[model samples]
Target: MNCRGRVSPGTAAPTEERSCSWLNPWVFFVSALVIKTAFVTVCLVVFLHGSDGQYKTLLQNATEWRCIPSMSAGKKESWTCCPKGWKRFQKSCYYLPADKMSWAESEQNCTGMGSHLAVITSEAEQEFLYNLAKGAATNAYETKYYIGLSASGNGQWQWVDQTPYEKAATFWKPGEPNLLFAEKCAAIHIKGKTDSNTYSNWNNILCFTSCYRICEQAVKVV
Candidate 1:
């Protein structure tokens, strides 16, 4: 009998298995490497996507917080944001400091904050300022607020930024500016509840009068 064609002592495996057994180590190693590479690639992709989503979410929140609500004719519009504790309206930010100051002192205070006393350009701005003054008053007593208008230079009503104040475009009281001889600075009179009709009108007051200041700063483009 031929011993090679039959099962021999301690050699019971088939011929095909015995011939391909030597390649087992290489196949196992290659398969493990491929599995590890695929796992690492999937993890990296997931991590990157998560990080990008989180960043975008944070950016969107920041942008939304920066936008402020501006009111006009009961309609709201988005505008640049204001600093902390300041109010936003149209293209400007206004701050009413609680400390009372004379006209010059108020101007200096505003300059220290990189701003100037409030400048009213249109009726909308004037009304907005009036509302701010009313809120700041917070009592039944009338409160006066100093603005940026002054007639100190040659008796001409002028803004701190040298914008000429047009009499025809002003919101002064009916007989206001009559004391152009002595009163040089301008103020907004916030009347009490009983005198609401006379509230928020521009008045020519003494330069040394102590009053709250309305600071104005232009909103920066985002």
Candidate 2:
């Protein structure tokens, strides 16, 4: 007997099977496109965030926190901020101790503390020390401070570390170093009258004279 639609055994399925098969490729293609788009979006977001973080780190390292970029309009972009209890100028740290000691004693104390007496190598450094001395003198009984300069018995002026002191680089007051024959040490007059020169004048004095001291050490950023 003829079974018609019921007699499907060993026979290929009709339109429904073909229709479902045709839709599978389109569904898989759409699904794969959506997954690829999501993956790309995630990668782009991560890349952008990493780039921004690196830029900010660069800015921070460049200034050692002394300055940073500003996001606000009309805001200052650079500023100066020193570490606590230490003065920051350029890349050095300075400490002006109020305790009075002899030139040799001051040097010893500084070395004991991992520093040395202020060594003026540039005019900018001199200016900084001079200004600091001026301020310190206001609170000091005698306005003088021992620096790292002295002369040998042979009249050769030298830094405490034995470097030659340039005569042209001297900041002595007029008619100063007058007692060079007897005075072997150098000191800066923080608050004194110089008829024809600037303040913070240098003078040759006895090495044992007691005065305030300035300590200088390098700043390390980590």
| Candidate with the greatest TM-score versus the true structure | 1
Clashing pairs for model 2 are: none
TM-scores of all predicted structures: 0.63, 0.58
lDDT of 2 by residue, 1-222 (tens): 222334378987564422235567788999999999999999877865674354333234333333323343786453344335667777677778878999999999977766678777777778788877776666434477788887888887888666567877778877888777788888877544322234438888888888888877665432
Candidate 1 segments exceeding 4 Å error: 1-79, 198-200
- Residue 89 CA error for candidate 2 (Å)? 1.6
Report how far off residue 181 is in candidate 1 (Å).
Answer: 1.9
What is each predicted model's overall lDDT from 0 to 1?
0.78, 0.70
Per residue, candidate 1 scores C-alpha lDDT tens digits across 15-116 of 642245557788899999999999999986786567435333324433332455455586644345656777888788899999899999999999987689
**Cα distance off (Å), candidate 1, residue 139:** 2.3
Give lDDT: candidate 1, residue 116. 99
